[model samples]
Target: MQKTGIANLPLHSGKAPYWLFKRMVALSRAIVELMIIELGREELLRRLSDPYWFQCLGCVLGFDWHSSGVTTTVTGALKEALRGVEHEFGLFIAGGKAKKALQAPQEIINYAEYSGFAPQPFIYASRLSAKVDNVAVQDGFNLYHHTIVFTAEGHWCVIQQGMNETLQTARRYHWLSFTLKSFVEEPHEAVCCDVKIPALNFTAKEAADLRKAATILSCENPEKIIKEMKKIRELSLPERHMVSLSDINPENFYKIFLQTYEKQPSNFESLLEIKGVGAKTLRALALTCELLYGTPLSFKDPARFSFAHGGKDRTPYPVDRTLYDRTIEILKKAIEEAKVERSEKLAALRRLVKITQV
Candidate 1:
C-alpha cells in the first residue's frame, strides 16, 4: 500500500477527509490493475468471480479510510452490493456443499453472517485489519462466519444491521434505489459494474414496475421502449401518468431511426427532452449503436471520471506516485527472485504493462 496519510485515523467513522479518500481511490485503481496484471486475465476474472476474493478485495478496498463515519458508509455499500448479487454471481462462485447451503431457504441468514454483515459492529471494527487477507482466500466449507438456516418457505431474509431512519422518512427516497449504472465507451471502454443501491422502501407494485423499467432501460432499443411507453400512456395506466420514459435508460436510439425514416427530429425530441437525458447517456448510446449497428452519434463532451471534492482545499487525494513507482520496481525484483528466466520475465512484464496500459 502506498502511504496516503489516511491509515492512522479512526477506521469505523463515516467522515473521512476528502483528500485522503480521493488519493486512496486512485491508489486502489493502481493496485487493482497491478494485481490483474500479475495474476493474468483469466485468473483475474476468476478471482473477481470468487466470493472469497470479492469480500477480501472489498474489505481491503475500504482499509484506506481513516474516518469511522465514512468507513461505516463504505462497508454498508459493499454489503448491499454483495447481497443483491448473491443470487447471481455470488451463487456461481460458491459450489457443492456451499451451493447446497445457498439453496436453503434461510441461506440469506447464513450468507449474511458468512459475509460478516451481522450486528456486531465492534467485532467488525476490531477485525478489519487481520481478517482482510483471510476472508479473501477462505473456503465456505472450511470455516463458516455465520450459521445457515433452512426455512420451509422460499422467501429469504438476513439479520442485517438495522437502519436508524424509519421507512416513512422520505417519499421520494422510498422509491429510489440510488444504484445508478454508468456506461462509458471511449479510449478505454468499460462499465462501472454494479454500484451499490441505497436503502429505500418501495411499494410492491411500484417495485415490480421499477424492475420492468430498469430492464427496459438496460435494453439496446430506445425506440421500442418509447413505443411501449406510448401504448402505456394510451391505456391510461395510473403509474404511467407519474413516470416518464427518461426514468428508464436515456439513450436516443430513435435519433438515427428518425433521420433514416422521417428525415426529422420530431419523434426524437420527445425522448431527448427528458430531464436526465444529458451527454452521458447520449455518449453511451452513440458508442453502443455504432458498435452494434454501425450508426454513429456525434461527440457531445469530453469524458472524465474525476470526482471533485468541496471540503479539501481543492487538493483532492494526494497519490504517492513515488511510492507507486517503487512498488512496481519491487514487483520486478520479485520476478527475479522467483528465478524465472529473463525472456519469460520480460514477456510477463510486457503483458502486465500492456493490460494495465501503464
Candidate 2:
C-alpha cells in the first residue's frame, strides 16, 4: 500500500545557504545512490512519486522539511549531484524552476537520444503533465517550478510545485508514469500542501459532466463563444454584472476561435493544443456552459490524504500500524546505507528523529 501525507510547505524566500545546501547535495546523493544500489531505479522512481516519501526525503536531507523550498532545493541538489553519474543510477533529471523548466523538452531530447530512446513521447508527457496541473485541475496555485526525472528504460516521475502567494504556501504535485491511468482523471500520485481551498478541478471524476459540457462548448464554432462575449459586453449591467466572458474582448476571443476553428478540436486535450487557448478563456467557457447548459461544476478540492497509515490524529481513520512500521523500516535501511561521513550519517539520523517532532 502507498503511504501518503500532506506537509505544510510555506513558501520560503532567498537561496538555501551554501553551507546547508552543500550538505543537502551530499546527503541527497548518498540516499539516491543507496536507493539505486539496493531498491533499483524503478523503486526509486516509485518512492519519489509518493508525497510522504518525498517529503520525508526532503526532511532527511536537512532542509526545512515543510518549506516549499524543499521541492525546489532538493530537486536542484539532485540535478546537480546526479550530473555525470547517470550511468550509475540510470536516471536523468530534466526541467526545473522558470528558465530551466522551459528547457525541459530540449533537455529530455538531448538526454533521451544520448540514452538511445525516442524523446517525443517523453516530451509530450512533460508538457501535458504541466498543463494538467496548471489548467485542467483549475487549482488557484500558479506553477513556477517543475522537475521530471526518468529512468533510462523510460519510467518517469514528476515533482512539480505551485505557489499560493496569498497564503504563503506551495502545493506539490507528484506523478509517476506507470501509476497514472488517465491524465485528466486523478493523475497525481499525491498532491501535498498545507491548506485545501475550494478549487475547480475539471480533471476530477466529480466534474465529468462539467468537463464534457466544457469540451462540447470548445467543439462548438468558436464564433459562438465570440458572439456570447459580445452579448455579455452589450448587455446593460446593474453597476456590477459580475463578469467572466465579459472580461474577454471579442477580438481576442475571436483569435482563439480562429486557431481552434480550423482544427475543430475533438476533445478537451485537443482543444488545449490550440496555441492561444489558456485558463482565463477556459474559465469563461466553463462559466458560460454552466449558465447556458446548467451543467453543474464541483468546487470541491480533490486533494486527499488516502494514507497507508492514517493521520496520527486519526480524524479520517486510524493509522495502519503494519504499513507505518514497514515505511519506517525501509527508510531506516536507506538511511543506514547512505554513503555520507559518519558525523553526517549521525546528523541524518537525528533529523529523522525530528520528522515526528515536526
Candidate 3:
C-alpha cells in the first residue's frame, strides 16, 4: 500500500528570521544536492512526498515541527535554494505561498520550454491536485499554498497547504505522480493535519458511485439539475455528509452548470477540471446525486511526525547555530568531495542510508 497519512499542525504567524532562513536555504541545498546525487532525482522526489520525512526535514532545518509555517517556509527555502541550479540537479520547484501559488502554471511552462518537455501534463497535475484537496475534499480549510516539485524527466510531487481559520489549524496535502492512479480516487500521498472533522470526501473509494452520478448529472441540462437540486433541499441528508443545504444554492450554480452541460465531461475528474466548478458546485452535484440517483457520498476525512535537532521557535532550545552550521558544512563538503572522490561518495551514501534507516 502507498504510504499516505495526515498531520495536524497549530496555525502559526510570523516568518522565519532572516538569519535562520538563510541557513535553512544553505542546509536545504546541501541536503537536497546530496540526495539527488546519491539517490537520484526520482527517489529524492519520493522522499519529499512522504509527510513524515517532510516534517522531519523542517525540524532539521530548525523550524517548529508542529507549526503550520513548516509547510510554507520549508518549500519557500527550497525554491530559493534550487534557484539557478535546477539544471545541474535536474530538479525544479515551482509555485509557493499565497500569490506565488498562482504562478505555478506559468513557472512550469517556463521550465518546460527551457527543458523541452510537454507542459500540459504537469500543469494539469498541479491544478487537479489543488482542485481535489480544495474542492473535492471539503474539510473547512481553504488552500493558500501550492508548490509543485518536479524533475527534468517529468516525475513530480505537489506540496500544498490549507488553513481552517475556525479551527486555528493547517492541513497539508502531498501528491506524488508515481503513486497517483486516479485524481478522483484516493490520490493523496499524505495529508497532514491535527484534526479530522467530518468532510465531504468525494475522492474516497466508497464515493465512486457518487462520482459517476455527479458526472452524469453535470452533462444533463442545467434546468433538470436545478430542479433536482431544489427537490433535495427539502429532504434530510446523512449527518456524515456535513453539507449545508443553504450553501448549495441552485441559482448560484446555473452558470457553472451551463458550462458543464456544454462540455459534457466523460468523467468526474474532467468535470472537476471545468472552469468555475468549485466546492459549492461539486457539493450541489453531490447532493443531487445522493437524493435522486440513490448514490452515496463518502464523508471520510482523508487525514491520515518528527523533530530533528532544536526547533526554530525554540521549543526545546534555541537553534544551535554552531551545530547547524557544522551540519551544513559537513554535507556541503561531502557533496563537493563526492564529485572528485569515489571513496568519499561511497562513504556519504553509506552515511545517508544509515540516517534514513534511523
Scored by TM-score, the top model is: 3
- Tell me the TM-score of each prediction against the true structure: 0.24, 0.79, 0.92
Please provide, for model 2 over 145-192, each residue's C-alpha lDDT reduced to its tens digit, 9 standing for 90 to 100.
999998877789998988889888888888999878877777788877
Backbone collisions counted per model: 11, 0, 8
lDDT of 3 at 102: 97
How do the residues 150-255 of candidate 1 rate in per-residue lDDT, one tens digit apiece? 1112211111111112221100000000111111111111111111122111112223332223323434354654454344334432232212334434234455
Instruction: Go through the candidates in order and give the C-alpha RMSD of each one to the true structure.
Output: 22.3, 11.3, 6.1
Q: On residues 152-250, what C-alpha lDDT tens digit does candidate 3 reach at each position?
A: 677999999999999998888889999989988999888877788889999999999999999999999999999988888887765645688877778
C-alpha lDDT of residue 12 in model 1: 32
The TM-score of candidate 2 is 0.79
